[model samples]
Target: MATTHHTNETPTDVASNGTAPTSTVSPETLLDYYRQMVEVRLFEEAATRGFRQGKVGGYLHVYIGQEALARGFLDAFRKGDKTITAYRDHAHVLFQGGDPKATMAELYGKGTGLVKGKGGSMHLFDVENGMWGGYGIVGAHIPLGVGMAYSEAYRETGNIIQLYLGDGAIHNGYFHESANLAGLWGKDGMCPCLFIIENNQYGMGTSVERATANTNLGSKFDSYAIPWEKVDAMDLEAVIAVAHKAVDYVRETGKPYAVEAMTYRLGPHGAADFLEQYRSKDEVREARKRDPIGLLEQRLLDLGVTDEEAMEKIRAHAKELADEAVKFAEESPEPDLSELTTDVYAPETGLI
Candidate 1:
């Protein structure tokens, strides 16, 4: 067996290296990232509170600190561009034009949800906005996104597919197998898939160092002959800049590309796990100081586009929106038992 080690002394930095891309946008773009990050941060916090208060139900995975990676990538793509991700998907769906009320209703298992109360937190689909769906099986959707790329290329559409997976999913055997196929497709200039690895330091409580031998994940794509890069998922500016470049590269070449986004989950792996034992309190605290939302808020103030009071107002507003979602969800009625037999098949015959 092969092994790699990381320590607190070691940077373990993927995008924080001095050579990573920096944002060169005007004040408006910086403020935009700040506003979106704050919005997502508050959204997740409110989601968590709702889950605890019994307003939101089922398995809730809060994308608390990884807002930059989600919103940054969403900003990089144009409308009708496709996006697929794993079950840490609330942020992705929301960024892809999903209404807060419908999303909240889905979490509440109400008839008004994005899935019409059919799929809960883990399974969300919005074909209208091109979100596709969030798969619960780990790494199962990798090939689905690649297949979408192939189909689109066949149809001569200019759109592209962005596939987001967590650090743990990267180690799954399907990841390597699907990557091999995606690379082959890209060689023919017919693939426009962006494989993003959201490296949040742990794969369900197992630290990346403890879990995998080849910890330099970006280099994995190197061996696959795919153009790849690493980015600071904690920094909205850096995330957006790198994602823009990667998306453009794939669009220009009609080839596959990968980005390893370095971030921390900040919340437990899911609602079921308290996420306490695997990491130290000091470590989480240190990571919080590098919070992407906080970083972008400071950047906005530095740019003078917004004052501290204004920024806080944005945060408060995001919370208020989430509160409204909770109220909408709580008041939603449960699905009728008679309808459980419907939508399972094409035929309208009742179950025996």
Candidate 2:
């Protein structure tokens, strides 16, 4: 009989040293991480409110429980690197140094928003900050992200693409085709892309267990010859530790890698998914116990690095920032009628 003794251990946990990792996050970094997580939490909450208030149009998918995934993975992000993901992309943009006001304004469909409100909530792009854009179609961006990495490899630019996709995409043809090409090109050291699978346990309402035959998402990379691993994404420190190594591996080898971030989404899939028959309330309450912000706060207290008063202050400031972003979105003006045809195509040319 096969026996697994460490089923409860996080992927980043030391193999020989119990469940506690040997590495320690600095007090300064811990505090900053807290600020980032809280801000995302508040900002996403505000966005949800806006959606309910009928301010936002199109599909709305906020990154509520997935903030730690962005906070940790993007910590390894270097200048010139590119990031592309699906619709739930606000957190990635903000963590990539995107402006909160602009992001929120986009959700509100204002002209001053990112992409000038042309690409609402689902398509926020800030190329200067290394974020390609949030795509709406499932598994569709896989090929595009791979192509971007191939471009970087061809130019010898030493830049990689952090291609983020949900677990659901792995079951589709888009992932298979794109990953196969990435593997073949990577053999020639021509594809430097890190595939981050944010496995939030559900693809819409269908759980991974019900969808996947093997259920080990990372091992799917083996079929395409890509090395892969899993990370405890809810633990921000753990994720950052593993992310640095993975980021370095792709950069040095100019090859593809995959990371299945084992995390859970603490909120409904979208604003309208009220009857969450897919999961129970008890399941959600238990997951909340491992909330990244809450975990970090407890860790800080255990280390005596920060007091409760200071933690409250940080949270207060996060709320202030969230309030400011919402206000900015509310005050911003909608795109004018002329915008309908302005960004639809390339400029007119004499020869054409």
lDDT of each: 0.79, 0.85
Q: Give the TM-score (vs. native) of candidate 2.
A: 0.92
Lowest lDDT 10-residue stretch of candidate 2: 1-10
Evaluated with TM-score, which candidate comes out highest? 2
lDDT for predicted candidate 1 compared with the true structure: 0.79
lDDT of 1 by residue, 190-238 (tens): 8889999999998888999998898998888876789788888888878
Candidate 1 has a TM-score of 0.90
Badly placed stretches (over 4 Å) of model 2 are 1-25, 348-352
Pairs of colliding residues, candidate 2: none
- Residues 1-352 of candidate 2: C-alpha lDDT, one tens digit per residue: 0011111112232323335433334667667777878888898899899989999877788777777898888767878899999988888888888888999999999988988999998899999888999899999999999999999999999988999999999999999999999999999999999999999999999999999899999999999999988888888877876677778888989999999999898888877777999998999999999887788788778879789899899889889988899899899888887787775556674221
> Candidate 2, after superposition: displacement of residue 256 in Å?
0.5
